[model samples]
Target chain A: MPAAPVIAIVGATGAVGVELLGSLARRNFPLSQLRLLASKRSAGREMRFRGGTLIVEELTENSFDGVDIALFSAGATISRRFAPIAAAAGARVVDNSSAFRMDPAVPLVVPEVNADTMQGDEAIIANPNCVAAIAGVALAPLHRAFPIRRLQMATYQAASGAGAEAMQELRDGTAAELRGEAFEPKVMPHPYAFNIFSHNADIDPQTGYNGEESKVIAELRRIFDLPQLPVGVTCIRVPILRAHGMAISIEFDQVVDPQVARDLLSDAPGLRLVDDWAGNHFPMPSEATGQEDVLVGRIRTDLGDPSGRTLTLFVVGDQLLKGAAQNAVQIAESLLPAH
Target chain B: MPAAPVIAIVGATGAVGVELLGSLARRNFPLSQLRLLASKRSAGREMRFRGGTLIVEELTENSFDGVDIALFSAGATISRRFAPIAAAAGARVVDNSSAFRMDPAVPLVVPEVNADTMQGDEAIIANPNCVAAIAGVALAPLHRAFPIRRLQMATYQAASGAGAEAMQELRDGTAAELRGEAFEPKVMPHPYAFNIFSHNADIDPQTGYNGEESKVIAELRRIFDLPQLPVGVTCIRVPILRAHGMAISIEFDQVVDPQVARDLLSDAPGLRLVDDWAGNHFPMPSEATGQEDVLVGRIRTDLGDPSGRTLTLFVVGDQLLKGAAQNAVQIAESLLPAH
Candidate 1:
């Protein structure tokens, strides 16, 4: 039997970190040994994976010894500090943070969209934002079906995307509000129960786009190499738990049909068409929160734009699944051809 | 004083109908006698007004007799069926339904924005969609500053826009899901909690826009008298209760400054400038839900579309108040300049 691959997971105690562990077990990623790393506070925590329990160790300069693949989800600060160290120790890093994404040398990737770009990595590959990763999969096939000109999108993001504490904040805040008790918001920037917050970040006094939204737009533009494409976006965080939804309107260079776009998406690997509007069936967070495939539905002619080429759709996906862990694993799956 | 005006309320038990009553009371509309009219199911309900109880009676041919002003909050079907009857009975009808909004002869009125043309003598005055009402408040000031040539808006509508039962649907459906109960959705076309749905109504074969969204765009154009202006819109229903928020991008003939726009809106009536991002104080649904004025905020220059005169903003308002009831009552307040 062949020796299993060595896998190391940084930020193992975080939200995306937990999802990474599950995706490993679900995909059954060949593993000779699993190493868990986290901040000093969370380093000693014990977690269950499949049948065995794993103890997390504090991530440090020398933590990547004998590691073949490192998954970084500790956040941009931790990733910025530790990712280069891991890559220098000869481990290929699948970084699920924004730290290295815009670096000219770093390849921002969604495996299904750009597996080829990950091949010549300087050992550290970037995972795009959750919304971008899911959108890329759906857009890749359609961009191939019809050359595009511009895109406009609005997102309904989930609480989980903010982190574990934010999710707890939503549940606790809502429960407390129900009980008529004071709910002091700790993790989230604002009340997280029944409200939506705009994400175009406070205009940077320089760049207009919020940090999060700018990353998605810039990464999509870079990933698709469409430097001049017009992308208009408004990102909103909602009171949902896991899945994020985007209302997308596309204006392609050539005219496109709803059926044709639907067929292209149906044939795409990373997407599932849940669009039977007549039956009140379409992409929904409740259904897509744990699913690997991005749900794209409500496809129709863009009434706002003329020329049959414009389309409007509702796209939804689990922020943890396709948005984070699953995409990282799929990238690792690309490097090692053997299942 | 001369004989006070006799007033009637149609669909007295509905969400907007209730607000209409409260707004009338709060604003102190002088009424010598009041008649509450509703369907047979809600006809016998009793509503208190100004320390007095008014019994809701069945809306029939004689319901509007001797009444000088009738406020209609029923659905479009009822409004379509009875608005003319009330007008023929010598009553000025303020119909809060889509049935008369697009009617060429019927004037669409937003007193603060279009009080000049609110001749109101068609005997039937129409109300725009809730989202449109809020959007109008934000856009009117900007249009005056720049003469808007085109508009692109995406709305985050609340459940209250669907009516009292839909608000109940969100509350009940959400509670049901929490209790692990099977949710039986009835009020909305789809489930109303923890989910978002599209507002593009079933499209007419001849026109591409949905019934609801089309009404908004058409009504906006008619009220603004920008008949040739291009208005592209996509409306989404979110899991909020009473306020509706819209993300709008406009192209103006002249340059738009976020600061100057704020100054103009600061002076504009029935509008509150809530765009202070430094304080993290943009208008949100929770803040706007119960407020009379539509809160306009998140003001910024459009980063894309090199034309540079474009501005983007988020506007939120209480669908029940400014969007429906208070708006109709405000028109009535306009008729009562002495108040």
Candidate 2:
């Protein structure tokens, strides 16, 4: 790899795409050139980068010709068809879609949790699902200390998980509802005005779990190297804009002190402890919206477990930052020769 | 007991108090007279009921003298001060606050789940916390069949639980947020616009569980007649208006098929099965806000328990209806001699 690689961001007009630019600029990533690539409709758009304007080029077979590092944030179908081609064009591909997350050859990575899984020569590095990436940062510390026996999670997801269009829909729909006007949802399957619903991902006929829940389960297992880890999750989309929150219950093999778990999490990478009991303050989507750290708090022994073998926690993270763009950027950073 | 009893609403100007009037009129309970009572500030306020307007009277020691039944929903402080006085005035009391819920003499009741716990001789009947009443109706049927070993719940609570003021705060805060204006949160401790936070109830220092959570655990145990039933819960306040949703994971003594659980919930009263797998439609707060029955769906085998001994469900109930006023009214109805 060259001293300063040419970095390319695919799907550069979407929510995570915009955040990718912000993360790269804020981190002061060493890059010789930056290329913004998107669909034809957004091809001529100009995006600000490093105090300069970069035009978004239409993604084509020739888009990755001289690119050294390509970050793909488009949908799975786009990644499935183009990631290999980008890799064949000599770019190290980091895909932020579910297309290759579960593939045996792909190293599903949450850099803080499983950076060692990445081999520099791999054709593609798949980013874990947003929930998996956020929750893994908080759970990894405790699981490493005591080994999680079982995991159960309930998510309060935001509209940005659906994309920039869904975020605008939430804003528009909420405004109309406040004015006592009816607004039809065109992006989200359900109304997004002060409402909550099951995730819009297609539900599995046999398992009864939605596609989003399944991805979190599979990706967390791969990220933790626990192939058969039992995980149960419910994903619900709330009316918030860009942050996701989750309530997680983890059962350990033996009794573990909550304070010990807290101590471990307080020292974990990419995590911040926000547990304040007297103040009645913990992780909230409002506080985590633009922050890179996953806010972890509300740590307590699980009252549901009489054996003192379980702990419950609340975690919040920016869906577009640490959950996607920042994580993908971190993986690319780890692949640099200096690391 | 009279066939047509005289009824009184102690907190008639508040959210649940107004709903109490609606429930009485909608259910067409046999009432000869209705008394609307509130604090000094709200006294003399006119409220509509059964196509006629009733003047709100200031609650006093003499308020319940000729009243056959009293429904109290002002707050825990008001209930703690006046519930016994009202009961002494020969009015059957159905208290909606947390004052007398755990008292051995007061029968905490969810009519469909455990009305048998209410003996006609009791002076005060305790209406459970919103989450307990809503969850109990759905969990009762399953626990009766499979005998629940443990339970874990994460709640998406609405603003109405805090009172009429908090609901308005949500609306005003959201409107201000949409317009890019700053709004101070006077009713809620935290920002209420398009955000989620830990339950605002005071947290217990020892357990790190908030008062709301503790009430749910203790009340659910009492309602189920399982004094030591292990229950783990996290109560969160969401941005919705009037309905509360919970994701519950239940562990049974043995492996319980999801289909069997579905059959039991389907036949259960006070519940409507809303699990439509193909439609990706489940219980949503918008659909549950004004409904009488609790919407139950997303029933599946919990993968968190590889033993197949656990099942998960998503339940949504109107916070003011099934959770508070309607439940209190149902208790008063059961107390009538017509039974």
Model 1, C-alpha of A80: deviation from truth (Å): 1.2
Encode model 2's per-residue lDDT on A1-339: one tens digit a residue: 787899999999999999999999999889999999999999999999988999999999899998999999998999999999999999999999989998999999988888889877998999889999999999998988899888999999999999999999999999999999999999999998989999989999999999999999988888999999999999999999999999999999999888999999999999999998988889999999899999999999999999999999999999999999999999989878978
lDDT string, candidate 1, B53-166, tens digits:
999999998888898889999989999889899989988888999888877788888876787777535688887778777788888887776798877777888888888998
Top-scoring candidate (TM-score): 2
> For candidate 2, what is the TM-score?
0.99
Off by over 4 Å in 2: none
lDDT values, one for every candidate: 0.82, 0.94
- Model 2 clash number: 0
Judged by DockQ cut-offs, is candidate 1 incorrect, acceptable, medium or high? acceptable
Worst 10 residues of 2 chain A by lDDT: A111-120
lDDT of 2 by residue, B1-339 (tens): 799999999899999999999999999989999999999999989999999999999999889998889999999899998988988889889999999999998999999989998778898999999999999999999988989889999999999999999999999999999999999999999999999999998999889999999999999999999999999999999999999999999999999989999999999999999999999999999899888999999999999989999999999999999999999999998998968
Report model 2's chain A TM-score.
0.99
lDDT of candidate 1 at residue A37, scale 0 to 100: 94
**Residue A92: error of model 1 in Å?**
0.5
